[model samples]
Target: MYGWIWRHLPGNAWLRALISLVLTLAVVYVLFQYVFPWAEPLLPFNDVTVNDQ
Candidate 1:
């Protein structure tokens, strides 16, 4: 999959590396800004319990 993307990206190695970095940052931004917020409530990460006897 990654090899395919690298092949499709325009220009030589330097330009492809820059493009890859930008693409990665964009994906991270989207996940943090939208996807994670939307999905957070459905996940059980915050569901904590404590028991005392």
Candidate 2:
């Protein structure tokens, strides 16, 4: 899959690398800015339960 993407990207190796970095950063930014926040309330990570003995 990654090889497919690498092949699809335009330009030489250096430009491809730069484009990959920018694409990676864009994905991270979208996840943090929209996806994670939208999904946070549906996740159980912060829902802690402490049992008393």
- In model 1, the Cα lDDT at residue 39 comes to 100
Candidate of highest TM-score: 1
Question: At residue 27, what lDDT does model 1 achieve?
Answer: 100
Error of 1 at 46 (Å): 1.3
**Global Cα RMSD, each model:** 0.6, 0.8
- Backbone clashes counted, model 1: 0
What is the C-alpha lDDT profile of model 1 across 1-53, one tens digit per residue? 99999999999999999999999999999999999999999999899998997
Model 2: worst 10 consecutive residues (lDDT sum): 41-50
| lDDT tens digits, residue span 1-53, model 2 | 99999999999999999999999999999999999999999999999999999
- lDDT score at residue 49, model 2, on the 0-100 scale: 97
Question: 25 in model 2: Cα distance from truth in Å?
Answer: 0.3
Compared with the true structure, the alpha-carbon lDDT of candidate 2 equals 0.99
Specify the poorest-scoring 10-residue window by lDDT in model 1. Answer: 44-53
